[model samples]
Target: MAKSLQARKSELSDQEMQLKILSGGAFETGELPTFKAQLSKHKIQTLRPKTFSILQLNIGYMCNQVCSHCHVDAGPDRKEMMTRKTMEECLNVMKEFTIETVDLTGGAPEMHPDFEWFVEQIRLTGVSEIIVRSNLTIILANKKYHQLPGFFAKHSVHVISSLPFYKKNKTDSQRGKGVFDTSITAIKMLNKVGYGQANSNLKLDLVYNPSGAFLPSDQVALERDFKKALKTDFDIDFNQLFTITNLPISRFLDYLIASENYEEYMQSLVDAFNPTAAEDVMCTNTLSVSWEGKIFDCDFNQMLGLKSAVKNPHISQLNQNELMQRELQLSQHCYGCTAGAGSSCQGSIA
Candidate 1:
């Protein structure tokens, strides 16, 4: 019986492993390393990262489209969502901190029923900057969201939209088919509202992540190529290009196992660990809040169900004095944050 079961297990294929990882959960196999160990190997501190002047908030975990590589694994099925009441609590807490920036993110942040209202409320505050990380295609996913560019314009939001790559094949391969076209259309609309052009008050930034198994190329070089290619081939215009690394998490982990690239990707990241990037990690300056009003050290940990240190736990029960004194959680996956030139939502952290 033991031999028979062993034989059956040996017959399991890559696709089989992927299905198990995807449906039952990635941890079912226990093959992947923990988030903290990965960070420690790279000499990156997985500890209480300092709170800087900026704050990056995850408004909710619910999103309309389920992309193939979404680190958060956000989609229509997700029930852990943020409510208006909780958002009000976040707003209340916002008043206690001297933060100059409030960044809102989500499955599709704009999909939040009160997304516009939240934006308006944040706008009313004297925060010096507002950054919205958007999946460009979401802007044209439906008619109701058609006027998003104008809304962003009104708020003067610093738009960081993901394009994966300028080529249709690459972008669609990672995100989804037809995503490239929709994203292009959204950019055109943003350009009309002064998004990417030089000297344009509307700040439009493009985010690029490699399609597979590697860290992103240099930012300045990639940005130049993107600008020239978009202008010549697609007649598109945008501001700075941000290069981000695709984190190993959620659906992406499933992809790695399915494609037989898990080991390769992990080893690649470990090989390219960059010390300079460690000094300016996003978590050092930004605080991340989950959909249910829980505080996290960073967005990555929030996705992994890691909560803030003891002094501050639940956002709903936030105490500014307590939060200011607490330490942070750390993990192995943080290697992705400091590898190579380093990666954050706004490109290289170093």
Candidate 2:
């Protein structure tokens, strides 16, 4: 493992470098409490799947901006993408299983060549919800994508975006130079299409992740602060704020290692473990599908190459019952989900 990590250090993209550091056992201090033991102490003998309802499809790892803490390590250089064949398989899974929500993610899911086509196809299946996890700035990324807001509104697509902070310096420091301004411009554009309006059915939600090695503040309180600030400052209105805990993986793990705060941060997650939150972790209901068709317990596990604990790890190989019967692949990174109020794509669990 050490030799492999050393080899990767030479040409590893920052994203792969972090995963290598983790899989190489460089970040496991042995001093922190094991996540499973925490479960046992709280009488959770086993973590099992509740149902298979949310189908999260990662279209590809291509993105326009390289954020400091992106778990996918997606940027302009990534070449891996989902083909129409794989997407057809995913759509079949959705139809056969009657999956309630179809979650679309990516470096910028919109960056996928077949993204819009995929959404159009999924809508025809009559799925309840189609969520597009966007980076916000992508709406203003290029002239070709200018029509995205109206397109989303026309389809009633639920939009969830990343907004690190309401201020410029904090947001720019984490995302990149000029990203904050571009994001704000994108928000206004969405508003023009009724994305954040109160009476509009269009749902526009924002996600906030801490910029450093710490758990996020309360979701409800932070949402209040965000609403007041965005309204007074930019007249922006959105449905909700999802405060996500930064998992110790990918670029975030790199930041923790470089800053010499890895041990402390790991301990922080361990100390905040909530059994109630453990019961509702997103993995219990959602199955994450990689760009190439591999299935995972969740998006974080997808990044770490922790495939589902089933015989067949790809979507094309497994049926719905086989998926729900599979156990989750857990690791130290899971502490991010069970810590504090607990975190998921939706927000706090407890």
Candidate 3:
């Protein structure tokens, strides 16, 4: 195992060199090969026929911020929100499938005009779990939405916020300056609403991606640091810390290619492949849905615009039996999931 980790690091070292040279060796710690390699492992390709869960619903593609590593490539440019009629179709389909969970995603899923109506309808279904991937800052984006924390609490929805880091500087660099402050505030709000408190029925999960470019430090260790820091200063408490690996797709892929970090990152992933993590990958359960109502095994495939080649690729026209029987799409980026400790939307798969 030690030798394998070393080999993986060495492979990343080569990519790190290229990435550094691309910017005249100005690459920061986040741009390092080790981190890039870590991000590359989680392919998130789903096994349809064996799927244990279904990720239904897409609010649309409209966001308040466009981060450097955003896989969605979302911004003011995206105008493809799910129409009310389309959402009704989704709800109709939902009644037919025994989907254990509903994972709602988008540029800013809440930005969709019909987002509330959709969520309310889903609430009626009372699925086992409801997950909403939020940017944190959005909850406090405006007066109307400022009360979202309360709404989420009322519906007993699980909240997943992308904080990037507990530190101000690193978070600002990847997301945007001042984003750290807003995110922190948002967390505190959720904490007030009982989202992150221990033993609280409301489940609150915080997501951590690499800052510069190194695989995340130990998840247990990082969680400790965040707990200590947020508690002492911000008085915020949260549940599990999910250490996700970034995938080489969309904006991040462009960053790597333009900065010449592509080959190195790819090589690093191939070397660090871990067999154990691959077996328990998120694709075993979760099904990712895209902005235009498209379906993928996971979010990574959605970033690359890789659609299901299965019998029923589009979620609107799903064929459960056939989709279940089809083989998943494969790509070089899959190494990210099999690397040391592995990675997935839920954090370290290993």
Candidate 4:
């Protein structure tokens, strides 16, 4: 049998592996502008948390399809999944804290055996909204997950799915063959459930990530293009289009190294660094919890094995007090969030 993704991940720290991948590049110390120094120059050396409104939980790394730019490298081959026990722990945190939003992500969060149960539990905790970072393809991967659209609507779950481009060829090139067609079908299904309707409380949003080494086009322009193209081509509508920069990590990192675009891409990110965006980076407000209950400042950090600044970085020891005051762990990949118009889980910061 093949080794599970988690089993392979456990063999070595992701951070160490990332260093090895960028070994021959211009990523040497003192070469690139340090994220902290940029913040300090802006006179906001330390980023503090505001109200803890969002709880971002990474359920696991098991998905229906593997995309080129997927930072998690999740696919059908991954067997690591969150147990009901860990989910129960997450529910406990939600019940204890006044967290208003719960963002569930994974290889494909819907693939988790206890996904529905966890969503139901968190909804009972009175979270105002739940965001599922769906890959789109999963909604139609099989009969088991086909009912996800209605299921999501029933619970008022906000769906934020990835549709790399409004065009089929570009999207399929980055995601997989026939992904664009399935994604359009999925969007139409979501629309049928009143997800993207103008007055519906059920919200459906699309996320756009650049398919190559370049930074994303202007978010406003890209959103306009996506809306026009998708509406014209598929008769589909969504609440909003979020443009996220592809962070330099995971499979994307490998692509950068292989194509010898590592230096140029990193330089572009650093050159386009916007300090304003850094102040409101999602990590400052959201706490990322891994499948096994480990905690990090953000999902990117989670993938890189950069733990939270809290002395006890686990869901069991979640300390809102310490977490609020601790400094975040940042690396070159953070430039992805600060480049140009600024990127975050939601969309552009400024």
Candidate 5:
């Protein structure tokens, strides 16, 4: 039997192994051009910040379900979580900067003991929008979480839940068994509180991640299909659908290697490279803060252990001017963001 990736951690740190895989193999052999090379070909010298509008905080890695394609490699057994100290530091940054949006994410961000407190604190910061990236089922995962929809509505939190596909078989295959049904139930609960309603201030959006090793189809088309199917089948409604590309990293990277799709996928991204998309990549305006308070250019880079190229790389030491001036850290995985219509937390850029 083959050893698990965790089993080889003693031989090489997980981050180190991922970095080696990204830097060597086809990349070193010149079968694929480095991300920097691709940018240079388009006369783009450096990827820099245009603004600091969104501050995405990944609060923890403890989750209920072990999805097949989780880039964070988050699961029930993982214990890494953000301490109140880190959360406080994050709040400080929000107070200091003109952050327009505060994005909260995790294995299940609600799993954190301080989750509610942190949300309340963020609301106090006067940030215009507060987004919680939830995995729908979590709202029904436990008796304690049953009132989450009400709580979210009370706070006017923007809920962005993941539903890989409208069909059960597809969603279950990628997420877990019974996830689609549970997610539907969770959506109903959210809807009961006025979320996803027409002209409702309470916003509830669905996120669609391609179930396979491929780029997502056009966002507008996918949104149309989702709205039609969901409304017809379950009488559900959502404000918008965000289609996010799964970058090669962590569990998804393992899948690409195990299924022998790494090379083909990389080539496809290269083939579909869009200069317009590259220019609008999310990293230019978003700053990703890891659970440990380490700052990164984006969440993908956070998982890859790529810190922002600023001198002050932690939340406590945040230097807004320096962070805005530093160039973005790049790697082969960046191609995932620049391919075709372009993928970001907000979905299709081009």
Candidate 6:
């Protein structure tokens, strides 16, 4: 019987284990071309930042639920949280730089003690967009969180919640039992607060991740089906649906290995590699900040403990010119982003 990597933390908590698995095996044996080689084949010498528009912060790693597909592997037992001082460093960087968007993520970013204060501070920075990646069920998880809908509306924060599927069974299977119902209720609360309402500016979007070791279907088609189904069945309304591919890392990687689907899934990604998608990968435009303020090319890289390929790779010491010039840190997991239509926090990029 297999268990989660975290469950066997004593045995496999080392980040190197995951990295070794990704870099070794087929990748090491030449069964699959390395990401660098693939890029060279397409004349992409190096993947570097094109802009510094989005600052995505992973505030903490504590969550109320442990979703099987969660790349963060966030759960209640995880205690890694960002300190207020570190957040202050982040704020300083925000004030120093012209950030267009501030995206908050975590086990559940809201679980952080000073999450609201952090948002208020970001607002003070005059960032044009503030995106909170909520898990949906968290909005209804506790009595204190019951007012999250109104709170989000007050700040005009863009709420991007995860809803793996419109149906209850599929959703619950990926998350947990009754998560779909709670999420639906939470959506209604957001709708009541003017979020996702027709013609309303309080934007509310839902994310869709494939429940298994497969790439997500067409974003447009999935969004259409989601809108029609949610509207007809529960009168739910949301701005749009973002279909994201599950990168092989963290808990999802555990699932792949445990289920003997690792090689097959990696092959699928390689087969569907799109150079256009590779060109537009999120790492090219977004900077990921870990809970402790370390910088990475993207959130997935942050999870793998891969810091940015620049000197002094910390938010406190962020240098716009240096970051723009830094080449991306790549691995087999990157194939997930370039596969098919390409996946990013904002859904398909190509």
Q: Candidate 4: which pairs clash?
A: none
Worst 10 residues of 5 by lDDT: 1-10
Q: How far is candidate 1 from the true structure (C-alpha RMSD, Å)?
A: 6.8
TM value for model 3: 0.84
Tens-digit per-residue lDDT, 1-350, candidate 5: 22223534532228878888888877899888899999999999899999999999999988888887888878776788999999999999999999999999988999999999999999999999999999989999999999999989988999999999999999999888899999999999999899999968999999999898899999999999999999999999999999988888888888888899988988888898999999999999999999999999999899889999988799999887898899999999999899999999998899
RMSD of each: 6.8, 3.5, 8.9, 2.5, 2.1, 1.6
| Two-way TM-score contest, 4 vs 5, winner | 5
Predicted structure 3: lDDT: 0.71
Model 3: per-residue Cα lDDT over 218-329, one tens digit each: 7889899888998898888899899987676556665676687766766666567676776667766766676566777777666555566675576678787766666655
Winner of 3 and 4 under TM-score? 4
Give one digit per residue, the lDDT tens place, for model 2 in 1-350. Answer: 01222124523344455455554443455555577767778988778799888999998988888787877777777778999999999988877886899999988999998988999999999899999998998988899899999999989999999998888888988899899899989999999899989899999999999988889989999999999999999888889999999998776776788899887888789889888899999999999999999999999889877889888888888777777777788777888999999999988899
Across residues 79-151, which tens digit of lDDT does each residue of candidate 4 receive?
7788888888899999888888899999899999889988888889998999999988898988999999999
Total clashing pairs for each candidate: 8, 0, 14, 0, 0, 0
Span of 10 residues, lowest total lDDT, candidate 6 = 1-10
lDDT (0 to 1) per candidate: 0.75, 0.85, 0.71, 0.85, 0.90, 0.91
TM-score of each: 0.86, 0.94, 0.84, 0.94, 0.97, 0.98
Model 4 CA deviation exceeding 4 Å by range = 1-13, 20-25
Clashing pairs in 2: none
Per-residue alpha-carbon lDDT of model 6 for 17-70, expressed as tens digits? Answer: 888989998889999988888989899999988999999999998888889888
- Rank candidates, TM-score, best first: 6, 5, 4, 2, 1, 3
Candidate 5 wrong stretches, greater than 4 Å:
1-13
Tell me the lDDT of candidate 1. Answer: 0.75
Question: Is candidate 2 or 6 superior in lDDT?
Answer: 6
